[model samples]
Target: MSQAITFKNRVWENAGLLLFPDNFDEKKTYPAIISIHPIGSCKEQTSSNVYGKALAAAGFVVLAIDAAFQGESGGEPRFIEDPYERVEDIRCAVDYLVTLPYVEENRIGILGICGGGAYALNAAMTERRLKAVVSITGVNFGRLLRDGFAGGTPVESLEAVAKQRTAEARGAALFVNNMLPASVEDGKKAGIEDIDVLEATDYYKTPRGRQPNGATSVLFSRLSTGLGWDAFHLAEVLLTQPILVVVGDKPGGFGAYRDGFEIVRRAKSEKKELLAVKGQSHYDLYDKPEAVSQALEKAIPFFREHL
Candidate 1:
């Protein structure tokens, strides 16, 4: 069963869905996992519906959260998608988890799916309390948005985004952005040919993965915030915790496949491992039973041995 909860982070309160093992006992401390949701997603989605529930059933206390500025959480200038704030949110989630007497403070692990996967890796670099980390179909979001897999966006584009930021600072309304196309057909009509993005439309725009509190809108100024951000920066020296990155061979248009491999290549952790699932696309791992099972099969043991 899941419980609705809220916790403080700076000036805002983040909403979360907490799950405990079916046989949870108050007398014993249990290993915990923080399952972070993807961009534009809330705790009710895959973060809880897929990984959160599964990990909890596997004897872990899982906490899946809705990031500030979106979902049911509290923050101003909503839908910011600021990567630094996202990292801070993960750290705050850790703060909340450690307060529970039934949670093993030193035995905590973190799991991030899709865009959240990037934030998890970034947060783990300095947050040593998180003993282990997992990134499922992880995307170094800032890098992906800046590079777009082929070549980086021009500096002029960043200048334009900065200009828009200045306009917003001058009291202009925040620029609104739709995170996804209305449907798969609209995505195709808009010239999106990547299998991962189209499948994302299928998931987020349809009943398959949609949630009542979920939304596809975000502030356009996030482009300026993440223009030069790199979630994996400094990971080579500071990311000493055990980490597991899972990616599908078919990265499709999003290119998280490359990001996953690069993280493993640069991480200093001796316990790092990368699981490349054959033939699966990025979205395939979101809710597909066969793909999710393959990931958990490896992830559970990795967390078991490390946490």
Candidate 2:
């Protein structure tokens, strides 16, 4: 079972859903796992809803959290998406988990989905308290934004972001980005036929995966920092914890397939594996039972052995 909770992340409070193992007891210590959601998502969605219970059932105390500045968390300027702040979110989760008497501080691990996965990998690079990490379809947001999903987006495009940020600094209203088409029919009419885009729209905009706070939009001003950030920065040098990256074989539906491979290839972790789910797309792993199960099979054993 899971219950709503909140924890300190600097001065702001991060909202979360904490799940415990079956037959849980406060008397015994248990390994804890911090599960983080994707950009533009909340604890009520993928992090808590999809992977949290499954990981908890495997006997790991799980804390699925909403990134600060979003969801039910307290922060100024709601919907902000800053990569550095996200890394702090993970570290602060560890801070809170360690305070619980029943949590085994040294055995803490982390699970991150979509963009959350990338942030997890980045956080684990320096957050040694995280003994193990499981990144599911982790996308390198900055790289994906700087370079398009299939290829390159001109570096000059950043100029537009700079101007937008300046305008916001000058008291202009915060601009928001609509991450997906309102409907599939609208996308088709606009001649947007990317399967990845379509499937994502279907998932986030439809009942299949929609959450009240998971509209998948972001504030336009704070985006430049994310565009400038690299989720895998210095991963080859400092990432030594055991890591397992699971991605779908179908390359589209976001570049996580490509980024996941890059994570395993670049992470200096002595024990790292990249599992490719055949015939599955990136979004398929979001809530698809079969695909999520395939990832959890590898994640559960991997975390158990490492943490």
Candidate 3:
């Protein structure tokens, strides 16, 4: 059974759903995993809930949470996606898990999707309490936003974004990214034919995977700050826990992770693996049954052995 729950301010007051295995025994402790959502996404998204429930069904307690300042979580200046704060949110979730008598504090693990995957790695870099980590279609948002997805955007636009940040600091309204074109015609007019962005659009803008609070738009100031972050920051040394990175075999499908698998490779952990799903796109793994099943096949045993 899954139950809605809240954790008081350790980093932020976070709202999430906790899933328990069937025939759960509260008197006994169980291994637990934290399911983190993608950038601009919430716990209600498919990545969080789908994996959370699956991990629960696999005999582990799972907690899927909205990041600080997003979804049901409380924070100031809403919708700002800060990578540092997100790493802290994962750590705070760990703090909450340790307090639950039914959770094995020493057996905690984490699974992150898209940008959340990077943040999870950042958390695992320092949070030794996390025994294992899993990243699916992981993206270092800072690099992607600055360099552009598959280098789709001109590098000159980064300098433009920097200028916009100065204007915002001078009392201008927050500059936000125009994620969707005004219409399909507008998208065509702008030549926004990138397959990755198009697939993401279909998933978030249409009923295929839409949620009320899941906005594709992001504050430019957030991007400016995020650009300075390296999800693999000091990872080669600090990241000793086992990690599993899952990506799509289809080219242009997994975005940065396709080529950036090298970043995850930098981890010093002896038991890390990068598993690519054959014929699947990054977004396909979001809710597609076959793709998700293939992912869990590797993930379950990785955690089973490590956690």
Candidate 4:
């Protein structure tokens, strides 16, 4: 069973989907998992069809949320994917979960996809309420853009773009080019052979994984805040909670996940482990049945043991 719910994040109201196991008993308290979608993604993309609902079906309560400033959540400067605010939103979801009579407050865990995965780890650093965390095909946005994807970007280019975006951020015409191809022809025109990039464009630009509230473009202002932030900052000492890092082994697109998983491996948790799903790209893990099933197999047991 699933129910629609809303909660407040300071003065702003946040909307979410709360999922319960089949044959759920209101009188029994069950373990809960807070499922966070990718950047520029909403609950409908993750919870409605994938991780959130699957985990709930495996006998846990799951709360899939629309981050503040995106999706159905309430916030100003829409489409701003601020890392700090995203981390707080995870904490806020935990707060809402703890208040429910049927949720096991001390047995709560969190799972984040793509950029959301980075924020989940960031939140677990300070918010000890989450007993375990799972990051799937995670990317540390700060490191990804500032340093460039896979290998590092040229320092001069990075600094130049930051300077330009920082200056334009305060102005009213805060528009930037959409990250994904605007159409299928655009993706084909780019001649990018990488399946991850190609699939992402298809997912967002086409009806395959599109959500009305999701966008491929974000406020240029986000660069000002996101560039300076580090997703794995202080993870070595502060992220003591048990963590499971899952990634795809798609040859060319695997570096981002490997980088994040490596950083998370430095944490102090003795229970931490990394699982690589062979023959899949990052986007494949988002909705592909075999990949999703493989991930849930490891994730469900990890949460059961830790949470």
Candidate 5:
């Protein structure tokens, strides 16, 4: 049975929900999985809840959270994205999970969707308690903010973005924009190139993935904080634990996942695996049965084996 629970993130003083398994036995310690949602999306918006339910049904206790400043979590100046605080939120979730009588502290694992995926990787690096990690359609926020997609712009451009944001902050405008831009027109139009699939637009704009709280952006003042978000840079060095990276074979997100998989593989860590789902697009994996089931089929076993 799932009951609403809250835990605080020391960095932001925010409390988010902890979704547990239905048949959770207080006397028995069970394996736990921390599932993080994508950017601009809350725990309930994306497939995190679905995954949580599925994993819980498979005999695991899952915690699906709303990141700090988003969803039901507590925070001021809503929608602000603090790269460091977000990572710390994951640690806080882990802290809360381990304290539960039904949770297996040493066998905890993490799963992140979209931007949350990147944070999951970052958490694995520092949080020794995370025995395994899985990233699905994850975006490297730092690389995207600094270099844009496909490395289209120089890192110097971020400073200009930051400067503009600083000016906006001084004016106290709050700079509201939808979480993920609705269209390329909403973003830096000149830098981004068009792709065939509606991966970005479909997920952020349509009801399929969009939520009332989704697509909101913090003021430009938050740019500096987000620019420093390099979640995967140290994957090669700190990822000694087991990892499983999943990607869709369809256009738009496939290449990035491939690149991420390669980066993790080169880490020379004995415990790593990569799976590319055939005929699936980035958004397809979010709630689509075929893709989600395939992913869980491969993932649950991996965690069971490793964690």
Candidate 6:
């Protein structure tokens, strides 16, 4: 059975879909998984719900959620992305799951897709409640936003963002650009390393993955809260927790997964595993059965072992 649920975390309310196992035994606790969608996406847009359904079929309670400022989650000036608040959202999901009678509080895990993957790792560092973490085609937003593709630093990028922030404070409307173009024909040409972004657009802007709230933009004239997003420095620390990093072998996301794996490995985390699926692109895992199933096959057992 599935139903829409609303829960509070501090002052804000978060909305999510709760899928319970068939023939659910309320008297006994079961492992639960909190599936988080990508940036600019809601639970219904991605395969997070598909995976939630699969996991529920496998007897795990699953909660697929819309992050704050996106979908049905409570936040002002919708579609804005705040990395810090997103991490807190993951923690909030954990808190809500623990209170359910059918959930095993100590066996809860998190699965984050794309940008949500980075947030999952960020939450794992401070929120010990997450027994295991899985990141699928996840980008290190802090690294990407601060340093672009080639090379740069967070401080250098912040200067540009700071100017934009100042202009917005001076009555300029802050623009929100779609990560993927609105139309493929009009989409920006992909650079050598941007095949993933192109593939992402193919899915996000199409009916296959599109939802009413899936693709959206927001204008923020307020500078104070609008332009602030810090990098996730705690990734190195988060490696201490059990984590599984999954990436496609395609050009775009594979490199990021390799780079992230190396960083986590160097951190000397003992329970980390990296899996790369051959011939799969970043978007293929979003709704494609073969790729996603292969990942879940590995992921479900990993979480079962650790959580």
Question: Better model by lDDT, 2 or 5?
Answer: 2
Please give the CA lDDT of all the candidate structures: 0.87, 0.88, 0.81, 0.81, 0.72, 0.73
Candidate 6 residue-wise lDDT, 37-84, digit = tens: 877788886634677887788788889988887888998767777777
**Residue 183 in model 1: shift from native, Å?**
0.7
lDDT order of candidates, top first = 2, 1, 4, 3, 6, 5
| lDDT of the structure predicted as candidate 3 | 0.81
Ranking by TM-score: 2, 1, 4, 3, 6, 5
Give the runs in model 5 whose Cα sits over 4 Å from its true position: 149-156, 179-197, 216-218, 253-255
Encode model 5's per-residue lDDT on 87-136: one tens digit a residue.
Answer: 88889998888888888899999998777887888888889999988887
- In candidate 6, residue 63 scores what lDDT? 90
Candidate 2: tens digits of C-alpha lDDT, residues 185-289? 899999987877888888888998888988787887677687778999999999999999999998874689889888899989899999999888888898998
Kindly give the stretch of ten consecutive residues in candidate 2 with the minimal lDDT sum.
148-157
What is the Cα-based lDDT of residue 281 in candidate 3? Answer: 82
After TM-score superposition, the amount by which residue 34's alpha carbon in candidate 6 deviates from its true location, in angstroms, is 1.1
TM-score of 2: 0.96
Q: Could you give candidate 4's per-residue lDDT for residues 83-179 as a string of tens digits?
A: 8999889888988988999998899999999887888888999999999999888878777666654124545544655666677766746655466
**Model 5: lDDT to the true structure:** 0.72
Single out the weakest 10-residue window by summed lDDT for candidate 1: 148-157
User: Candidate 3, residues 254-281: lDDT per residue as tens digits?
Assistant: 3645534875679998888998888988
